[model samples]
Target: MNAIELLCKARKAKKEARSEIPLHHALEVRMQERGWKIVYYGDEAGNRKLASVGLSDFSKDIKSFAFRSNTSKVIAIDSRMPAKNRRHALAHEIGHIDLKHDLAHLTSGDEKDAERFARLICTDGTIFKRIAIYLFCILCLGFGIYGSVCIAATDDPNIQQIDVSASPAVNADEVVHFTASGEKYHRPYCSAIKGRSSFATSIEDAEKNGLEPCQMCHPDIN
Candidate 1:
């Protein structure tokens, strides 16, 4: 089925799931029900600074991201966005999660549908709101196409990949490292896992399991 059709079905499903609560609250409840965690970045002063420093490589235009693994799911929202826009962004990411869209590679059409789905979920579903959502999506699509072209023009071959996964279940109490089909365990933010299949584990567990430290991230030493 096409994106719109998928979105319509998702909307119907959401309505049936919790028709009484406000959309944002309903979405949050839905996420919790599915065992997904919601994290807001840039909430504190230190966090805002850290977010800006860490995400410098990403376009500031990007608002939120969703990450899913075999055992865990997380949706990180940008705390800097206006309240309404943040809600829309959260809903948009939820659309991605619910529709089973691949976060690593989303086409322009998928992005449009996701944005429209978000708007529909957030607003009162009036015709005027729908038209506005369409226009906004078109604008976003144009920006996305332009950005893709820019990235293609300056493609770099040596960029390190970071692996972010939610598998083997993480213990909130433990400091850990990650490895995906590799001999070495890496820090959660290490570039070595960029495109690799990996899961997080406690550092002690990693060593006990015979996983070595990543030379770059030095999870073993740190």
Candidate 2:
């Protein structure tokens, strides 16, 4: 199987997020729906940090990574990572676990698949296309037979119901002011809060920076 094939399989499994939803919640919901648990704790067999990897040894280059088993473990994303990166890392690791190639002990090819999976789930088509194209080139030139093998074995029957909301298109320097309509509050998830004065384009951005969603608005939930 090639990257396209892997992606086609993933798509067939209904794994794509909604076209425009915020990447963070879209990904988290998808992960749970697909049976990959998410947690903030650090004791899982895999951990997140400067980089994400599969512990199943799917790729030799990785010092560590997550693997697929009936073990019922959390994705173990690094709680301390920047919010944007933490979202991608967790999704990438979930790709590895979902692909189930770790049992074969193949590395690079699986890593590529995982990356591709991450791209598909966590990004827009423009970005996903770039990563997929790169993987196709590497698949043909780099791993040869092993690459083909890894691709062939990648399949799962899970899909995500993503919201498909566009990431806010705003200049970073734009002064985004909020009005506290009755002491507005936004709660995105188990952590973080938001207020009328929050200047972020999105609640997730605020939470990533260690701020919570407005308790009244609950931007994270929407």
Candidate 3:
């Protein structure tokens, strides 16, 4: 079909639909209504299945193709492509069906017509397409903000880093150290604690516990 004919056909079909659906899904339903099976394959396993039933030597270069199965016509598309390309390819294959091209013979004479059909159907301005475009923009914005946050975390010199291996802050004058069995408290590193396994407490706590300063370490000097 020419561009105008294709557009009219698509618009007529859209007006007949009970409700709106995604363009790709609507295309699948369009083909399905004619008893055609649509298969979207991505991985090697899916490719293998399509190869067995449809094109055995699938050119990785092409995105989609159509074939006549024993029971019904089948359309196969490469799912690895981005959603937009995948839809375009599927629509292109559907274009072949709608245009009544010889699927088995496969000729290039009508390639342009099929391409036009795909473009018209995909770009024909629908509420679903508008919503999809808006959602895609939102997703891109979210990723941009997340990526900016990640970059700032890695590149900003102002971000503080904690030295987990360093010792905690301590006020020497406010704290005193004593051994588990000792009767007196002394400053850390005092001679009295040089060979002792000591613990620490506040100076007031030590004094309240009836502990005195060690004379040998001159603990009271601090």
lDDT of 3 by residue, 9-50 (tens): 444444443347887888788778878877777788877777
Q: State the lDDT at 184 in candidate 1.
A: 71
How far does residue 192 in candidate 1 sit from its true spot (Å)? Answer: 59
Compared with the true structure, model 2 gives a TM-score of 0.45
- Write one digit per residue (lDDT tens) for candidate 1, span 36-113: 777677657535543544542332456687776676577777788798888888888987776678977887877876
Best by lDDT: 3
Write candidate 2's Cα lDDT for 1-222 as tens digits.
443345544443233555366767776777677776665433343334222433433333432345456755446555556787777777677677667666348688787777777666665544553444445445545533221111111133342221222233444332122221112223222122221111123333333323333444454444
TM-score of predicted model 3? 0.49
Clashing pairs in 3: none
TM-score for each of the candidates: 0.48, 0.45, 0.49
Q: RMSD, model 2, all Cα superposed?
A: 19.0
Which should have the higher TM-score, number 1 or number 3? 3
For model 2, the run of ten residues with the poorest summed lDDT: 145-154
Instruction: Estimate the overall C-alpha local distance difference test score of candidate 3.
Output: 0.59
Give each model's clash number.
Answer: 6, 37, 0
